[model samples]
Target: MRFSATALLALPLLAAAAESPYEQYKAKFQSFLSNFGVAGPAADKASAPATPSISTGKAKKKVTEPKPIHTLTLDNWKDTLYAPVKAEATQPEEWLVLVSGRNKTCYSHCLRIEAAFNESATKFAAMPQSPSLGYVNCDDQPVLCNSWSAGTGNLWIFEMLPAPAPVDIHYKRLNLTTVTSQDIVDAYTGRPDIQWRKFEGYFHPIDGFFAKYGLSVPLGYFFWALGAIPSWAMMLVVSFMTRTMMNRRMGDANRQGNAGGGAAPRAAPPGDGRS
Candidate 1:
């Protein structure tokens, strides 16, 4: 009778937990997601309640799974892509792209964007399981700049996990309120929800090719010059050989004409008859 009553008492709790929403359970991480603008209003509303709680009969050892293949932001985003990381690896590796130039041509907004990227990148690079950071100087290397779909004076974030792993890499292009130091860092780390645009890389387009291969305009020219130098050299050699052959022919003709036109043939015949 006691066991029957106990089972009856636990029935409502089980139903409540089973009926609760999934986001309500991940309440701990929701605030951070909201701040980063990753999870939007629906998530914001769902995070009030903690994760579902169901009675398991006996105490189970708690095990937390390491988050893997994260692009696990607000769930809906502008652009998302995936690549595989190698099997044997050491630490987390990621990238953030700053699509701007350093020359005199770089505008005021470009400089500001770079500053924000640099500031956040530095801090991110130093953290535990931190990611490596890099950028492009569009003035110096324009070929690859178009892939991120960000024009001069904007930023693009990339998370590269090159080492071997069971999961594929994820890339998220996020949007935010403004460009400021640590703004990108915050964007990457996860914060309040913000409106973002997706990056569309195209292979048919010039910029798309560069983005797909991570190449640049200057690099293309360098490759062209490599092949061109050899072609030009071959042409010069052929021209020189033709000139030498023509000069030899002209010298031979001049000698033959001098011998034919000279009075030497008559004198030689007279001397030989006298001998």
Candidate 2:
């Protein structure tokens, strides 16, 4: 009876000892603190404000603005300015040349002018045929400088007729003491003499064909296939005719040989009897 009572009492103690490690550790810590005369809030009763988890996601890309086109020199003049104009320039078309010096005052002023022109480049591109803008460095190109007579700190506007023979380039000095981007654009577009050439004749059969169908963007491969069909058909027809002719000739030769040749001779029997 005494052993049974002791076992029942030890059963509850063993069950308490089998509790979670966190609960047991907390209980022991609390007991240790109590033994040292230190008081703290109960583990279950105490509440703490949670610290938010910081999430590190992908970094965004940096956006940068486009750099403006600066002053044009003789080396880059043809590629940057003149070539584009030449490719598009029809008869009676012209280019607008902006001439300036490379000195401290003129260079800064020219850059300001160039920046203004660059901003309006999109607007110019929209036109059917717009005058190309170019900068002439007077110090570098003395011949062009003398030809245009581009004075230092002066901005001149010119109409260039890019003709094959006797290249005619005309200039009319602008009366602007203070130049702006809009001023250059206005002067070029507003000029009454700037003539836009019209498409005179059909350059190719395909061009005419597409035009007849009112198709702006032609399917080039479709046209190429269409063009190849006739040649391919001709080649096939020629090959078939040649093959038929050869087969007819072979048949005729066989028929002729059969008609002309006689049966096998009985000479072999006679020769064997003679031997």
Candidate 3:
């Protein structure tokens, strides 16, 4: 009779446990806390599962930064910048590079941000995995700047890939306002919070007519210009050429008449009968 009564009483407790799983979890969590010297009931601690050592992540030892800052000019950009980064790697490597586009005429805009940009570059250069920092002055190296799609007062971030892989441009942001070092670091490590605007000619198709033929089709354009000339314009050219020829012939005749004195006797021949 005693055993039956005990079993009937325990049934309600088991039912409560099954009905509230969250309550059981809470007790287990409390017990886990108790393992860390947190006070809890002995029975609860005894029922808690053994805890295992967990590691969030390993910390990497930071090394000294390299000479990240460089000037990308027309003369050395191909050999210095492009060739080295594009070299094949035993294990694939990706390089993060940041480029600033500025002009001497951009004093009002670029000058203000220039100080902050330099400060950020100094900070970024100290990072263990520092990014390549470079700048292109449009006026100084217009061709190189154009190839990089760099416009004045703009910043570009690109991921340089190995050979055969095209460079990946991540963002192009106009630097109207100066930013802090933390802001720059966050932007370099991850993406910036603000919306990004594209560089000039973003909407232009790269493989356009002029881009395809370039200098090779220069004379070709002249031929096309000739074909496109209006009929009235062609008539004007022809009229001008004919008038020039007529003037030259008349001039030659005048000169010949003066030199030979043949024009003086023509009037006497005509008036011979009347005289």
Question: Poorest 10 consecutive residues of model 1 by lDDT?
Answer: 72-81
Query: The CA-based lDDT of model 1 is what?
Result: 0.51
lDDT of each: 0.51, 0.53, 0.58
Which residue segments of model 3 deviate by more than 4 Å? Answer: 1-67, 83-86, 90-105, 192-275
> TM-score for each prediction?
0.35, 0.35, 0.43
Q: Which stretches in model 2 have alpha-carbon errors above 4 Å?
A: 1-90, 104-111, 140-143, 152-163, 175-177, 192-275
Ranking by TM-score: 3, 1, 2
* lDDT by residue for model 2 (222-273), tens: 4433444677797998899999999999999999999878767566544555
Q: Candidate 3: deviation at residue 161, Å?
A: 1.9
What lDDT is reached at residue 195 by model 2?
34
The residue pairs that clash in candidate 3, if any, are none
Locate the minimum summed-lDDT window of 10 residues in model 3.
199-208
Q: List model 1 lDDT by residue over 13-101, tens digit each.
A: 99888867655656756777888779644536666777788887998766433222222111211122223334354443454445566
In angstroms, give how far residue 80 of model 2 lies from its true place. 7.7
- Where does candidate 1 stray beyond 4 Å? 1-85, 89-92, 103-105, 146-150, 161-178, 203-275
